[model samples]
Structure formats: structure tokens, C-alpha cells
Target: MACRSCRRQLALLMRQTTTATEFQNVAILRQFVATRPPRLDQRRNFGSTPRQLGVRDIIAQVFKNSAEPYRVVQATEHIYKACAREASYTISAKDRTAGTIPKTAEGEDLGEGTTMWHNEFKLPPTFSTWSQVTMLHMYLIFARLRDLDREVARSWQRQLIDHYFFDAEEKMDLVHGISSRGLRHRYLKDLFIQWRGIIAAYDEGVVKGDSVLASAVWRNVYKARDDVDVRALAAIVSWMRLCLKMLDQIPDESLYFQTESVFKWPAKNEFMLVDKPVRELEDALQPTVTSAPAKAPVKVAAKATA
Candidate 1:
């Protein structure tokens, strides 16, 4: 009987010890959980959540926000077309025949007199001259876009070049009377090669500074003529740098939509040339901001020497 009683006591003691041990283990686990640092919820949620919108995203959002892919493409095409038209307009001959020509004190035909181009740059009114000027403006925009997302830049550059060639082909048909598609295509192919060469040359010039840039302008745009005016070369180089700086200041969002107005050329006065050397043009192209000097604090007089 005593042996059986002792056996029961031993079994009861063992059960109690097991229960206590289990309770202590659970307590320890709870403490460990409570003291543990919070899990990185942000990291945990990263894969599930969408990324913040970037410039490219904002551009893509245009398509989504419109909900029509065709409309988005049409709008983009129209925008680029308008930009190309504006660029071409810079060199388009003004309708000098629209109004009566102004007479000087001497009854000379003012229209027959030397014009700005004749008086200053002496650039002839030729298709090549107009095309060069147009390309200059286009190149400025291209330079500004170099830092954009690769795909975005590629899309814009392709569209812009398309608009340019379209205009060029149309002009060839209408103005030059090259109605043969084969001939126009050949001309355009040549111009595309020229365009690529100009980009490479101009990029090199920009890296090397104003003198190198002027040399490129003379070579490509002026046809490397020995008689090319140094002053005109300097002026064009100055204008390019100025336009690039202006475009750089504009935000990417603004550029995506309002490109035509944003990329407009500066006023004639803004490009006025001084008699300084070409090196000075670099300084002229840089952005300059002048601020008013801080006012000195006013001194207060003591109470009438009281």
C-alpha cells in the first residue's frame, strides 16, 4: 500500500513539474516577443506597393489620364509639329511686299537698301541658310533633352527629327520643285547624315568651349567657307549657348507640354554682340543674376539727449 502511495505521489510531482516548466517557457517566449525590435514594415510592404511617380511616370500618366492611347500620340505629334513650325518660322522670309516700303529722307527705295542680313551677317537668302538656322534652334532643344530618361529622350528626338524631315521634304516638293519622291528621299538621306555629323561636331565643340563651337558652326553651317565672318560665327555660338542655358532652366514637366513657347528664341537685344573676342561670348551665355544690396540698419537717436 505504501509503495503504491509513493508511486502516486511521484506521478503527481512529475505532472506539476512539467506544467510549471511549460508555463515558464511560455512566459520567456512572450518576453522575447515583447522586447524584440519592430519588424521593418516598410521593407515588408515595398514589393506590394507601387513606386512613387517619376518624370517618366508623369509622362506615362498622360496616356492613362486621357485613357486613349491614340489621342495621346496625336497630341504629342501635334505638339512636336508646332515646335517644328516655330523653328522654321525663324528663317522664313518676311512678306516684305505686304506693306509700302518706308522711305528715308533721301527718296531711296528702303526695300532695295541693304537689309539686316546684308548689313550684318551677309548671309544669303538661300534654302541652305534657312535650314542651318532652323537646325541651330532644334539642336539647342536636343542638347537640353540629353539628360532626360533615355526612352523619353529617344521618343522626343525621333518625333522632332521626323517633323524636321517632313517639313524638309514638303519644302523640297513645293519650293525646290523636287516632286520626285526618289530624289527627295535621296536629299533627305543626305541631310540625315549631315544632321548626325552636326550633332557629333557640336557636342564636341560644346565640351571644348566657344572657339571649338564656333569652328563647328563655321564648318557645318557656313560650309567651311574661307570668307565666313568671324563676328557672325561668334554671334551664332553665343545664341546657341544662350538658348541651351534657357532650356536647361525650364523644368521637364514644363518642357513636355509647353515646348513651343518655352523654346522660343531670345529677343534681338538679348543677342546683341559686343566688340569683344569670342571668349567673351562664353561669359555672356552664362546666367547672371544681380541682387540688391542689403539695407543698413537705421540708427535710433536717444531721447533728445535726456
Candidate 2:
């Protein structure tokens, strides 16, 4: 099918063509273009007449700017399925080599030369990386919301909390035989790294931290900077949806302790220093505490004897 831009342009072309024959010619040209896949030749050339540039050209520009990540979570699922299949293996047999099999004069060997195949799983790094990137994007969006509305911010935070630890634990439980050490030590390790990166990004200006976190943060969040071509909002939405889907696969009570332990909400202010943004938000959402002092200060009397 012609791209949205091409279709829009064709409509305008029909309007511009005054004569019936010209309109027919334009229709034929549009049909011919539609049948062919997009090519450099089909693109508007510098030499093209003013008629070539119209609503289509304007739309192409608008569409280009309107680009956003779409169905990323769904795309991630497809990738996961591909990865799962790629890593799966089954037993099979190999062909017998020459002179390997014990055969009769007719060249039929009865279990003399034998070959076998063993099961194997071929895991791909792409799947893991994609999963991590999607999670990071999800966290970033939540981080952005943390500044906007308190309820929305809280929901996102809860989602991040519920998702990273609780949801993942459940999912990991499905493969019953999978070892805790492997799941905790390896998978959670990577997730923890992503989690820390999210915190670092969100608290870059406000928190007291080393530059190492800053330098490494962006790299961990985006798998390949070049591969991600979407608005930040769209990317996060895709990831959030993916996280929801992942929630279903999670088994009950997998391992939330390790997940929750990775991130700490900023400490609440007791003395009300220059309230930082997070602290301010926290204090507002939090209930106020009214504590009475144990003892009032006693007034000292001036010395009577000089």
C-alpha cells in the first residue's frame, strides 16, 4: 500500500488536474506508484513541478514529526517467543557415515552404526537486552510523572514497585525447576542494575551521588540509541503494557524482597530543610505527625548575690 503521505498527495494531485485526461493520467500514475514498493525514484525530486508538493508533502512532514514508538510491548513479546523457540531443543538422530553401519550385502545395516543428537538451548542476548531496555523506558516514564501529578506519580511508582519485584517473581516461578540462585543472582542482578540506573536518572540533580552513575545510566536504559526511534512517552507506554503482560507469566511469591531492596524512596524530611521536590511531594501525600515535646525549657534566674 502507498504510505499515508503518498495517498494524501495523490488526492491533492487529482484536485489540481483541471482536465479529465490529466486527472486520468494522474490516477494511472498513482496506481502504478501504489503497486510498487517505496523507492528513491518515487520520492519527490527537486525538479518536480509545484503540483507535486501539496497536502501530501505537508502530511509527510507532520507524520515525520509525529513519530512515536508503537506496539513496542507487543514487539517485545514476539521477540521473546522467538528467543524462547530459538533456545528450545529436542532430541534427534544424525545420518550414518560411510562404512559406519554394520550392513548386510544389500547395504541395510541393523543398528550397527548409530548416531544421535542431544538437546540444546541457544539463548540470544537480544531478548535479554530488549527486555532490559523496555523496563528502563518504563521506569523513565514513571520518573517523569513523579514530577507532574501526585496520584499519577504514586500509581507509576507502585507499578514500578509491583512490577519489578512482585510481578517478576511470579513470572519466574512458572519454570518450576529454575534455581533460586540462578534467578536471584543472575536475572535480578541485571534488573537491579536497571533499577539503580533509573534512580540515578531520576535523582541526577537532587541526589548526592558519584558521576559514575550518571555516565552509565543512559547506556543501560537504551539498548541501542540508534534503534529506538520513538517519543519518550510512547516508548514508556509500550514498556508499561509489556510489563503488564509479563505480570501474567509470573508465579506467586517468587522473590519480592530482593526487588524491593534495590530502590529506596528518598528519606522524608524531619526538620524541613530546603524541601527538595521529591521530599515536598512525599510530605504532601504523607499524613502530618504532631508530637508534643517531653519538657518545656525552664527559665534561668539571674544571680542574686554579686
Candidate 3:
């Protein structure tokens, strides 16, 4: 009998082997036969592609040093994975990639080793007011843990807040409200603040270099308002304000801010107008932040939880 055939028989016999020494020999032979030969012996060629991981992509995955915990860390990771899977289908559907892994500038296969969320919503169709709102809340939590560009984060945040208000009102069908007049004016007033803040952020260079957030926010905003009624828009803005308040109340120690920092005072002078409203909202929404034994800011920073 051939050596290979003999080995197979031995392996089969080992399964039923009752004698200890015989079983041991059979098992050893079976392992030898089943073991894969080295690549040179197999004579097969192999290659792998490489790419650069973006700063945002890395930050998105890391939850260490965050004021928040790992559960929120897990959620961000889950979202990224979900988005990545969606990106694969969407990119293929749009013919952006030809049934292969996409790469960033560094030639590393961009989507392969990374989480899904970054790739999937990198562009529209996946982008929406709801997504923007959800992500901003995540971002705010993250911001408290890290030092990011305060103005840029704030500008995008303001836009997302405005968008959610209008969106929430429309969803609830509370456009006319129980009192139609009170609804419209306050809603409109909030919308005006959001719109003007976003515009002013652009004018004042708050979003000067934040192309990614700026472009995405504006695209979603425009998509939400193609020939829609002015009142519908105002209602959307009001609804968004309520969401912003809720999001603001999300504890800094929550999992979402694991590696991020919430903007206490983003931008030098940008807070001048928004501070009052932010303070009022915060007073209503934020829990009393217990003092931590009056430690120095550096000392506080040192033992801070993520």
C-alpha cells in the first residue's frame, strides 16, 4: 500500500484503537499526514495589499483614555463594522471599486482591516439627519477625552442639532402643535440660531479646514430641504433642539466619550452668542458635576477615566 494510503488507514484505525501505545503511534502518524507542508514545498505564490490608516479611523476605534467606558466603545466599533459592510455593497453598486478592497493614499486596503462605520457613511445615501445627530452625540463624548479642534467640532454640532429639531417635529406630526403660534415662533427662533451659527462658523473660519464634517453636514442639510415648506423646516429645527438638550445631558463619564472630549468652550469668541442658550439648556439638562476634591487641572487630567 502507498505511504499516504497507509497513513489514512492508520488514522482511521486509531479512532478505534484500544491499545495505548498503538493509539499513540497512530495519533502521531495522523498528525504528520494532516499537517500542511511549507509554502516552498507546495510551490504556491501569495501576495497582500497594504494601505495607510487615517487619523480619524484610528481615533474612531480607540476607546482608551476616554472619560466614557467600553460599552460605548463597543457601540462605536459596532457602528463602524455595520457601516463598512454597507459601504462594500454601496461602493460595488456604484462601481466605485471593481469588486475588490478599496485603498487609501498609502496603498493599504482601506476597508479590509478597519471597522465598517467609517467607510459606509463616508458618502451620502448613507448620510442623514438622524445619523448626523447620533454621531455628533458620540463625537461630543469623545471630544471631552481628547483635544480636537474646538471650532470645527462645534460648527458641525450646531448644524446637526438644528437638523434634528425639524426632523423630530415632522416625525411626531406636531407641526401645528397644540398651540400652533407658540410652536412656529420659538421653533423658528431656534432654527434661525442654528442656521446663523453654522453660516457664521464658516465665515469665521471655525470650519475652515474641516472639509469632511462641513461637506457631509451641508449635503445632508440640503438633501433634507429640497423644496420643503418653510414651516416644515422650522418645525424640524425645534425638534432638533430638544434632541441637542438630551444629548448634552449624556454624562461625560458615559461610554461614548471614552477617548473624546466634550467642548466646554470651543473656539475663542464663538461662544459669545451661544453660551447663554447653552448654559440655560445645560442647567436644565446637565446633572450636578460633583467636585473631585479640588485637584489641579493637570492632576484631574491625570486620573481621569476614559
**Winner by TM-score:** 1
Candidate 2: stretches off by over 4 Å: 1-127, 149-152, 170-177, 181-190, 202-218, 221-306
In candidate 3 the C-alpha lDDT for residue 185 amounts to: 62
Better candidate by TM-score, 1 or 3: 1
Can you write out model 3's per-residue Cα lDDT over 160-268, one digit (the tens) per residue?
3333443334422331122465665675566556545454443333234433334334444434334443333333233333333444556544524322222222222
Listed per model in order, the count of residue pairs whose N, CA or C atoms clash below 3 Å is 0, 5, 33
lDDT for every model? 0.61, 0.38, 0.37
lDDT of 2 at 1: 98
Top candidate when judged by lDDT against the true structure: 1
Query: TM-scores for all candidates?
Result: 0.56, 0.26, 0.23
Model 1, CA-based lDDT: 0.61
Tens-place lDDT digits, model 1, residues 1-306: 466335533443443344433454455546544654545565544334323323345445443433332332344455555544432322223433343434334432233213343345665544565566567667877887787877557655655665577678776765554679999999899988988888998999999999999999888767788898677777768767877777788788777565556545542323356355455877889898999899999998878755
Q: Which of candidates 2 and 3 is the stronger one according to lDDT?
A: 2
Using TM-score, rank the candidates from best to worst.
Answer: 1, 2, 3
